[model samples]
Target: MVLIDRIRLCLEKLLEVFTVFLLIALTTIVLAAVGFRLLGASLHWYDEVASIGLGWLTFYGANLAAIKRAHMGFPGLVGSAPVALRASLFVISEIIVIGFFVVIAYYGYLVLDILAWDRLVSLPSISLTVTQSAIPISAVLFILCELLSMPGAWAKMRHGIDSEHEAIEEAIRMAEQDLQESRS
Candidate 1:
């Protein structure tokens, strides 16, 4: 259990780093695109590249959002349910989400396999598989984060913050604040 926890932590940190790098690349690409447009020399592939980058950014950003519990949920509907029903619903929902991602990861793997036989249109140096690979990677990361977050959700259900949830929440809040400041 301890080793598993450590591995989860390491994986989460790695995802965080990867997300940051993608965000930086997205920003740079957008800025460069803007600059090129200003000079009346836009790269024909800039829009396509930006679109792909945006997709990667959104997917990775979702994993980060899950880590912070920032992903939207139907809390109001859940709140109106009876206690026993609510608990069951919550568990079922998580299970469904996990299962859904597992399917997505599987299909993503298939897409990646197909892409292995092709290359990007403009970026021949990069395989299409490399781009599509983010799908399964992000899906698995999301599943892991969701599982790790179960204890926190359980804590909230008991109307209290477990120490683990509190610690993770505090870290997430701090990181969010830093991100906001950087953006400003």
Candidate 2:
């Protein structure tokens, strides 16, 4: 559990940094595009690249969400299940979630082949494969994040803890602690 926690933390940090960079880059590109257009010229690659960046950001952001367990879930429903069925529900849900991603990654890879000779329409120098690789890459990252977070999630499930509520309480506790420290 400790090892998993450490690995998850590391993955979370890396994703945070990468996503931030992607956001900044996309912002800069969009701003440049707008400024250039206002000046009577426009970047041909601006729209395509920005769209690709947005897609990448969404995929990677999703991986971070998975690591933090921030995605939508039915904890209330699962928690309400009879104790005898909770374990089964847990297993079934995990199988379904992981399996869905596996299928996505598989097809995302196949799409790369179909686009093997394709390049960005606006920027012929850049291959579509490079931009589209985010699909499979992020899918795999999400699976990794899910596995890393599963132990803690299982423990919480066993104890009937709602992670969303716990997260809110933790935030309030942290704010109070910060206020106390300032007074001291």
Candidate 3:
């Protein structure tokens, strides 16, 4: 368990760094595109490349979210389950989530073959495969994140802990603290 925690920590840090790099690159590209457009030297590849970058950002951000367990969930529903049923429900939910990503990764890989000869309309030198590789790559990353986080998630579920509720409660407590400080 400690080893898994350490691995998750490393993966989380790596993802954070990569995602920040992607964001900076995307921002630079957009600013350059805009600057060029204003100078009447519009970049033809701007739209396509920016779109691809955004897709990459979303996919990779999703993996980060998966590792952090920050994705949307009906925690109340899950936490409300009877203790006897909670374990089964948790397992079923995990299997469904993981299985869905597996299918996505499989098809994403197959689509790369179909797009092998294709190139971006504005940048013929750049293969469509390169742009589209984010699909399969991020899907695999997400699955890995999901698996790495499962033990912690199982522990939480077994104890009927709802992360969402916990987050809200924490926020409320912080707000109350601030209010008390203001009063003082």
* Top-lDDT candidate index: 3
Q: Candidate 1, TM-score vs. the true structure?
A: 0.77
The residue-level lDDT of candidate 1 at 41 comes to: 96
lDDT against true structure, model 1: 0.80
Q: Each candidate: what lDDT? A: 0.80, 0.91, 0.94
For residues 3-81, could you state the per-residue lDDT of candidate 1 as single tens digits?
A: 6567667767877898899889989988988999999998777776878898998998898777656676766566566
| Per-residue lDDT of candidate 2, residues 31-147 (tens digit) | 999999999998988989999999999999999899988899888888878776877888888899899999999999999999999999998999999999999999899899999
Off by over 4 Å in 2: 178-184
lDDT of 2 at 134: 96
Q: Which of the two, 1 or 3, has more TM-score?
A: 3
lDDT of 2: 0.91
* lDDT, candidate 1, at 182: 100
Q: Estimate each model's TM-score.
A: 0.77, 0.92, 0.92
Ten contiguous residues with the weakest lDDT in model 1:
157-166
lDDT of candidate 3 over 15-111, digit per residue (tens): 9999999999999999999999999999989999999999999999999999999999988898999987989988888999999999999999999
> How far in Å is the alpha carbon of 162 misplaced in model 3?
0.8
Tell me the spans in candidate 1 whose CA falls farther than 4 Å from its real position: 1-13, 160-184
Model 2 clash pairs are none
